[model samples]
Target chain A: MSPPLAPPGWSRWLVPPAALSVHLAIGQAYAWSVFKPPLEAALHLDGTQSALPFQLAIVMLGLSAAFGGTLVERKGPRWAMTVALVCFSSGFLISALGAWTEQYWLIVLGYGFVGGIGLGIGYISPVSTLIKWFPDRPGMATGIAIMGFGGGALIASPWSAQMLESFGADPTGIALAFLVHGLSYAVFMALGVFLVRVPRPADRAAAAGGPSAAEGVRVSARSAVRTPQFWCLWIVLCTNVTAGIGILEKAAPMITDFFADSSGPVSASAAAGFVALLSAANMAGRIGWSSTSDLIGRKNIYRVYLGVGALMYLTIALFGDSAKPLFVVCALVILSFYGGGFATIPAYLKDLFGTYQVGAIHGRLLTAWSTAGVLGPLIVNWIADRQEEAGRHGSSLYGLSFAIMIGLLVVGFVANEFVRPVHPRHHLPAPPKEAADVQRQQSA
Target chain B: MSSDSSPPRGTRNGLIAFAWVWVGAPLGYGLYELVRKATQLFTG
Candidate 1:
């Protein structure tokens, strides 16, 4: 169903919370790891087998967002949120069935494929609308919503762990946990579906008349992909994500490995704490740094994300495990930049291509994330594995991987430098009078 | 546009407050949980 246009004086402030509801629900995907060990034990599967659902979910997230983006833009946020709620909640229900029946493939099909589509659509659903509503502070507005996605795991992780602790991690308990998640999230996400409103044409026109309106080259998603600027952004996102996700994916193990020879080796619980700390940094960065981008400009902020991010890697590499506090601080800063990069990109796209099809454009850009999802873990894990085979231990095990990440950040830095405003040639022409009239009529 | 045709000022303010709280409470709980967990790194 198409969302109704906002009535006059409808507070734009209401939009972020509406956006957050869906984001917070879908963001539970990040906590998928909490289920991995239990799934492995229950199904008698290997680590790789247990990881399949999360991997496929990530892959599906990118593919569906890329394909369904135009549809989401066409249908509006209310419809998209409704669809996400249905898909996400049902996927969990289906997984519950699979767990109860001891069918691993069914769980994959349900959680990975169905739930992943929900993640994709839900992620971009409110982004363009937020940008439209808060023309003056697009970065901060979108950041607030996107931060919910990063922070979602903070809620889901502990909640899921507590549930498993209570439920015994057996198949019956797993099924019950999934059932609760599916039903509860359905109720929570319904709030967003009901609350979302598109800006009225009159309201948009009034906003456009203001100084900070995002008015410029109006590139369609179809045309945006053709521009050099888009590819540059693709590189920028991919590398930045790869660098941060590498450490993130390996955070616990990497920290333990780094400090193996120290005066006090990091215990498993402390390593878990480090991962939790990184999550905090990741969530905080999404809001804090993205709001900073609104003030400093998107391009300049990327310079910091890529440039200073590389320095953090260098510090970790040089100091190794000698200094625990230094290593932790550097890792926290790098994770923050990672979260900031995700939050700030929509505003960056708005600056370059305008908001005509920004959600769709943003959808296409997330293919970079999907690619990084694979590339990051592969680089870190493969290097660490080789180091182990070679009998290397302690901090030396990750030095080469750290160096490679520094190089990747440098590449992203160059890519950010290459970005420029989209050319006028790529801009969509103004709608003809008849078409405009018809649109106005439909909106009215 | 002026606030002329908008809902009553008190109604609008109340809705905004409710909406923020709806999302904020959960997020606050999550942050508190994370901070509690993160402290183990320093303490342990």
Candidate 2:
């Protein structure tokens, strides 16, 4: 379908904020860890029980994004963003009610299930529209929007912590925080809804003035799934994500273990500093590395992300805890690659499949993230817990996990090497029936 | 598309500035917190 075009003289630059508005708000999901202790204490729940909300939210994010991607593409960003705004805001409000009532299951149902759908839909809603707006610089364009997701936690973590502290950390306080979050995010995301516009057909045509790499292949999301390229990229994304998330999911405690026997053990506050640095690295890498892809090419950048990433893991495995500086540098670099892997993948899809259904394809691809999210932390935490049980201390606790991460990165690197352009056979064919209907309408 | 006309320089600059501010406001706050935390860890 010919999408509605932006008005003449509409600045393409305005679109990223619209995307950022939604991403930054939904990105609050990453900060769910901030609520764990408080929730556990207040609700008289265990660690696993408290974590169910976050875990279920993530699972729902992937599921909704995968299923609703086509809807985002079909209905346009306005429809997608509005749905996201409602689902996301209402989820928070519902969770607030659950909190007030002291119903843990309601909190789980509201935040995990309903809020997660918001995350999924909100995440992919602006992607395709941004690419369409910035055909000239798809990498940079997408990086700008997606970087907000990474940055979201940086904003929410401290803010949420402060709110919980000030509000008293009881059920009443928790409900208040949830209420504030829901209300504020609804206002924040509405900016995107109103500001976002599809490039007019004429503008789109004008924007594609010359034949370009993005015009090379046009694959629908369904067809993209059939291609080896898609699956290869999936493996590449999943493995890379798994490796990074492994360390990230356990950063604070892992650092303390690494330095437990050192001249001075790393303090809890210092470990928090380390985590904050990793978050900085993740956010910076999203923008910096993805923008670099615009210059170096997407496939080549993945080589750096996967190849050098594995080497970074190897460096840490060999010599990490010996020097705190070395350990920090390697960990920061690896985390950056993780963030870059996320920010770059949309542009990578644009490269291989054209813009036809890139958003849908990107949505479907997020299932890999959900998979890695589970697998990565499990591998790292499980091994770490076992090592602690067995009287292992210091770097040895994570040495084995780091080695496994390196192996995963190598697998990703190999998969990246195997990625070639999608075959022409997978490209979407023009539908004659739609063309005839349009022609008949025009004649009438 | 390369064929699309660029918006006026003043308008475009204004839009770019607005876009950056929109995304950068929260990011700047996050950075502030990170810096504050790091400072506390190192100096305090």
Candidate 3:
């Protein structure tokens, strides 16, 4: 093949499509919950048991991203995107085989383990690249890519539901849906690979290692751990995700249970609607809330996400079991913030550490999500499960969980407050503007 | 964790700046609303 035409522009535009492809495809993980009731009913599994696929996916997302960060950064976006596509699509295929065989563990292994790798790699691939492209607006660039991740569920949720309805809820049907997903996504993600391009030579030469490089925003992964900023962000994200996922994991039944004896109760259809609304908010948060991080500074924006998010959780815990509209709205608002937290975090990382090795640092940071994924669900589900066994009704079941969430938030708030400027020793000056000069010379 | 700044300024195209604002605003507004509502839940 002829020498690859030097990708025109900063090749930054390629970053969004690349990020979105992985995000949108792996986003199918969020739709795992919709499959649980059917799987449980069909296979006679318990709620906890059926949740394996999603939990595994979340776990894998963190693990892969953590390990793969360096690979993506070194190998370049093309390699990373390709790996994401294959693993993600293959996970579906394996899960399809499991569905056909009525082997639940196969589903767990295929969709959860193998597929999780895709989720993790796909997540980190575009972030560092985007920062490289938009050194001036690290927050905005990362936000755009991350938004794709949050929004992917919007398309996947309904699409999965529809597929299941058409295919029949049995082993054969579920398998068919999984098969279709695998095939379709391979095609979708391929679009990204074909389109993506690394930064041109001139651009790299121009910077010659500057501070503004989004990669340089933070310390090296090793050094980063020693910094307070990383831990502060960890607390902020963990708490925010914990609060949001706390509500999201229980969104359907949580509202209806609260209203079971209330003056105005939530109907089944309304519960479904509530789930849909939350999805909308989740998608919107990825795009809308994160981009905001660009303007306001990632640190200040996170303060709002954590501090305000706490209060919302408190409202639902305190008064949620009473008012129907208030309960629904507040929970949703919290979920939106939760989605925003995921979307905005990359930008936050960019602000703290320079973009050098940001992909790796971000990969490391996502271990926080993995931790929260377990913590959030366990706290909510375990507490509710205990309450149900103890003969408590409605509000009492969630009181303890909500209280725990509040404490997490308060802790997170302190973490956010603890954030100080990066110590000077870790500093890397911004890349000099040679690319601009080159462009000026070319134009003149 | 350095208190350093990098001005790796790319081409100052109004095009990119315009695109940034267009995309960033909605995200900002969404976050602002979430915070505003979370705040209002108490004060309002």
Q: What lDDT does the true structure give each of the candidates?
A: 0.89, 0.86, 0.74
- Kindly list the interface RMSD, in angstroms, of each predicted candidate in the order they appear: 4.0, 5.1, 11.8
How would you encode candidate 2's per-residue C-alpha lDDT over A1-444 as one tens digit per residue?
Answer: 234357677777778888998888888889998889988999999998999988898999999999999988998888888889999999999999998999999889999999999999999999999888877778888998888998788889989999999998999999999999999889888888877888754454446554355654679998998888999999999998998898798898988888898996788888888888888888889999999998999999999999999999899888887888888899999999999999999999999998878999999999999999989989998998999899988889998898899899899989999999888888766456534543444454
Model 1 lDDT tens row, A227-328: 999999999999999999988988999999988877889998899899999998998899999999989999999999999999999999998588899999
Model 3 chain A: which ten-residue window has the lowest total lDDT? Answer: A1-10
Off by over 4 Å in 3: A1-6, A37-49, A101-103, A201-218, A388-391, A427-444, B1-44
- Candidate 3 local lDDT, A56-122, one digit each (tens): 8888899898888877777877778888899999999999999899999999999899989989998
TM-score of chain B of each: 0.76, 0.66, 0.52
Worst 10 residues of 2 chain B by lDDT: B1-10
C-alpha DockQ for predicted model 1: 0.44
Ranking by TM-score: 1, 2, 3
The list of candidate 1 runs beyond 4 A from truth reads A205-213, A432-444, B1-9
Best by DockQ: 1
CAPRI grade of model 2: acceptable
Instruction: Evaluate model 1: give its TM-score.
Output: 0.94
